[model samples]
Target: MRQSGTVGFWRWRRNPLKRRSDVVEAWVLLIVAVLMLCGLPLAGVLAGLHVDDELQHQREERQRTTAVLAEDARAWQAGRYARYQATVRWKASDGTEHTAVADVGPESRAGSTTSIWTDGKGELTGEPPTEAQAASAAALAGVLTMGGAGALVLGAHWVVRLSLDRHRAVALDQEWARVGPQWGTRHA
Candidate 1:
C-alpha cells in the first residue's frame, strides 16, 4: 500500500530501499531499448535488400520465350481463371527445340502461339515475380526476419532479468537469515 510514485525515477532516486537488482534491471532495460530501436529496423532493411537481390537473380534466370502449342488445350471453361496444362514446343537460344507441358488458357488450340517462361536450358519454368510481387515478397521477408530478431532480443532480456531476480532472492534470504534471530532480543 506504499506510494509507488514516479516511473523511471527509481533509477535516479536516492532511496535506501533500492537494491542492486533494481539498478541492474534499469540498466538492462535501457540497453535493450537502444538495441531494439536500432537492431530491429536495421535487420528488417538488410533482410529485405538481400531478399530483393535474390529475387532479381531469379528473375534474370527466368526469361520469356514464345512457344507454339503442340497439342490443343481443353475448350474454354466458364470460370474466370480457366487454364489447363498442355504440351508446348519452343526453340532454345542454341536453336535446340524442346517440348514441355505448360499452363495455358482453355481456349488455346494446337499450333497457336503462346509466351511462356524458360530457363537457360530451354526447360519450362514458372514466371518470375513482377515488381509489385517482389516488393511484397521483400516486405514479408523483412517482417519475418524482424520478428526473429525481436524474439532473440526478448529471450536474452528474459534470461538476464531472471538471473537478476534470482540474485535478489538469494540476497534477501541471506539478509533475513542473519537478522531473523534478533527479533526477540529487545531486552537482551
Candidate 2:
C-alpha cells in the first residue's frame, strides 16, 4: 500500500512531460504560458496608463482658471516670444498658494490668467495628450485584453483535455479487461 501510495503521489505531482494529454494539450499549454507571461507586464503597463488618464481627467474637470488679482506677467527677454515668463498665483483644492512661471502662446498680459493645471513635473501647464497618444494607449489595452483572454481559454482547454484523457484511458483499460479472456492463450 505504501509503495502504491508513493507511486500515486509521484504521478500526481507536476511534471511537464507526464501532464501532456496529446499534441493538442501540449500546444495549448505552451500557448497559454507564453501569452500569459507576456500579457502580465502589458496589463500592468496599461493599468498604469489608465490611472494617469483618470487623474488627468479629474484634474481637468475640477480645476478652473480664475484671474490672478495680485500677480503680473514679467518678460525675461525682448524679441524672444518663447522665452517669456511670468509669476502667476493660483488656488488649489486645498486652498494652497501655488505659484508658477506661466507660459502661454506668445505672452500673457500682466493682468490676464489662462487656464492651467498642475502636472507631474510640479509645473502648472496647459497641455494634454494628443490624439495619437490616446489611440496608442487604446490599442495597447485591446491587445493585452485579447492576449489574456486567449491565454485563459487555452489553459482551460488543456485542463479539460487532460481530464478527458484520464477518463478515456480508464474506460479503455476496463474494456480491454472485459474482452481479454476470449483471445488469451498464453504460451508462458
Candidate 3:
C-alpha cells in the first residue's frame, strides 16, 4: 500500500496524515546534521590551536642547564627500568648555586655532569616537549574535543527524537479512542 523511496522524505512532503510533530522532528534532524558536519569540526580545530599556542609559550619559558652530582647515585631497578636519584648542584645565570635531588642514569658518578631543565627563576622543572610531542598533544586534544561535542549533540538529538515519538504515540492513542466506537459498530 506504500512506495519504497517515498518513505525517506515523507515528513517533509505534504501529506494529510503528517502531524506538526513530524515537521518539528525533520527540522531538528536538519539542525543536528549541520552541527555534526560543520560546527563540531570547527570547534575541534580551535581547541587544537589554543592548546598548541599554550604549549609553545611554556616551551619558550624553559631552559636547559648542566648539573653536577653532589653525591654518588646507586642505580635501582624497577621492573625493566633502572634509574638513580642523587643530589645535584647547578649555578643559575645570576651566579647563584642551587641544589636539588634529580634522576640520573645508572652509570652516573658523584662528579658526573648531566643536563636538567630550569624555569625562568632557575627552579628545576621537567623537560620541555619537542615539536612532534606538542603536535601530537594538540592532535589528541582536537580529537577529544570533537568526540565529546559529537556525543553531546547525539545525546540531545536522541532526547528530542524520544520526546517526539512519545508525542506521536499519545496523539495516536487519542485518535484511536475517538474512532474506535464507530469501527466496532460498522463491524457488528
Candidate 4:
C-alpha cells in the first residue's frame, strides 16, 4: 500500500494558507482598516470649520469696538463686572477702516488690540479678543474635527471589511465542501 503519511503531506502543501480565497479576504480586510484610520480625522476637520461660535469670533474681527486699558484696581474690578466701554479699530474685509465702542474684558491691556462685535440691537458687547482665544478655538476645532473624521472613516472601513470577510468566508466554505469528499477519500 502507498504511504498515507506522504500523501497527506502532499495534500497539505497544495494549500498553504488553507485556500487562495483566504488571501483575498485578508487583503480586503487590510484595505478597510487603512481607510478607517484615515477617514475619521478628515470628517472632524470639515465639521469644525463650520462651528458657529468660532465663526462669530472670527467675524467679530471686522466689527468696530471701543478699547480701554484697565486703569486702577477699582476700574479693573468694575470692568470685570460690568462690560466697560472699549475703543477698537477694525478693518472690514473691504479694507475700510472703522472704529467703534464695544464691551471688552478687563484682561485687555493698554494699547492691546481687540476686535469688537455689535449685537443686533446696536449694542456692542464682548471681551476683547485675544490671540489665545483665537488660537485655542482653532486648535479645539481642529482636534475635534480630526477626531470625528477618523471615527467615521474607521467605522465605514470596518463595516466594509466585515461584509467582505463574511462573503469570503461563505465562498471558502462552499469551495471546501466541494473538495471535501475528494480530500477525505485521499486521506482515508
- Clash totals in order: 0, 0, 0, 22
Which tens-of-lDDT digit does each residue in 69-98 have in candidate 2? 234555566674535566677776566677
In candidate 2, what residue range of length 10 has the lowest lDDT sum? 62-71
Q: Candidate 1 or 4, higher lDDT? A: 1
Q: Candidate 1: give its CA RMSD in angstroms.
A: 4.8
Which runs in model 1 stand beyond 4 Å of their true positions? 1-27, 74-81, 185-188
lDDT of 4 by residue, 1-188 (tens): 86777764443344655655455555655665565565545655555565545656545643454333333112323443565555555544455565665555556655676555544333444543466665567668778777666666567656866876788789879999998878655443
Model 2 clash tally?
Answer: 0
Using TM-score, rank the candidates from best to worst. Answer: 3, 1, 4, 2
* CA lDDT, candidate 4, residue 9: 45
**What local lDDT does model 4 show for residue 159?**
81
TM-scores of the candidates in the order shown: 0.73, 0.41, 0.81, 0.43
Kindly provide the TM-score of model 2 when superposed on the true structure, using C-alpha atoms. Answer: 0.41
Error of 2 at 35 (Å): 16
Query: Pick by lDDT: which candidate is best?
Result: 3
Clashing pairs in 2: none
lDDT of 3 by residue, 1-188 (tens): 88888888889889998889989999999999999999999989999999999889879988999999998887655657767888899998888999998888877889999999988889888998899999999999999999999999999999999999999999889999998878766443
The candidate that wins on TM-score is 3
Model 1 lDDT per residue over 22-108, tens place? 888888898889779998999999999999998888789889999999898863444767658678999999899999888887778
For each candidate, what is the lDDT?
Answer: 0.88, 0.62, 0.91, 0.57
